[model samples]
Target: MKIFKKNLVKMTMKMVGSLALFLGAMVIVPTSLVGSHQPKCPDELLK
Candidate 1:
């Protein structure tokens, strides 16, 4: 019983860590690409 509980805790931690990493990448990649490749608008367009 103790071993099973330990294994379950380890698995849960691993799952949570991977989920957080995946979500971070999903958000960071698009924002980083947009920051690097955004196009400038003409001054007239802003007026």
Candidate 2:
């Protein structure tokens, strides 16, 4: 019973870590892409 409980806790932590990574990437990736792009402002405006 102790072994089973330890294994279950380990598995749950692994799953939660994976889910946090997935969610972090989902938020970070799109924001990074948007930040990297130049806006469509005219060259004259940039000068």
Candidate 3:
């Protein structure tokens, strides 16, 4: 019973950590997109 409780707690923590990381990435991605410059490229560069 004790082992089961410990395992449950570890799993819960892992899940919460993953959720936090995903949320952080979600917020950061759009922020970088908004701050980026327009496609600065010539016709040759497009190839």
Candidate 4:
């Protein structure tokens, strides 16, 4: 029983770590692409 619990904990941790990495990449890739473009705001909207 103890061994099974340990394995379960390890598996959960691995899954959580992978999920975090995927989410981080999802956020970072878009920001990096937008940053590279540096879109300018339109002059009409400045009013």
lDDT of 1 by residue, 1-47 (tens): 99999999999999999999999999999999889986889999999
TM-score per candidate, chains pooled: 0.74, 0.75, 0.69, 0.77
**Better-scoring candidate (TM-score), 1 or 3:** 1
Residue ranges of candidate 3 with Cα displaced over 4 Å: 37-47
lDDT per residue for candidate 3 within 1-47, as digits (tens), equals 99999999999999999999999999999999987867677989779
Output the TM-score of candidate 4.
0.77
Q: Which is the better candidate, 3 or 4, if ranked by TM-score?
A: 4
**Candidate 3 C-alpha error for residue 33, in Å:** 0.9
Tell me the whole-model lDDT of each prediction, alpha carbons only. 0.97, 0.97, 0.94, 0.97
Counted clashes in each candidate structure = 0, 0, 0, 0
* Local accuracy of candidate 4 as per-residue lDDT tens digits, 1-47: 99999999999999999999999999999999988996789999998
Clashing pairs in 3: none
Q: List the residue pairs that clash in candidate 1.
A: none
Worst 10 residues of 4 by lDDT: 31-40
lDDT of 2 by residue, 1-47 (tens): 99999999999999999999999999999999999998789889888
Worst 10 residues of 2 by lDDT: 38-47
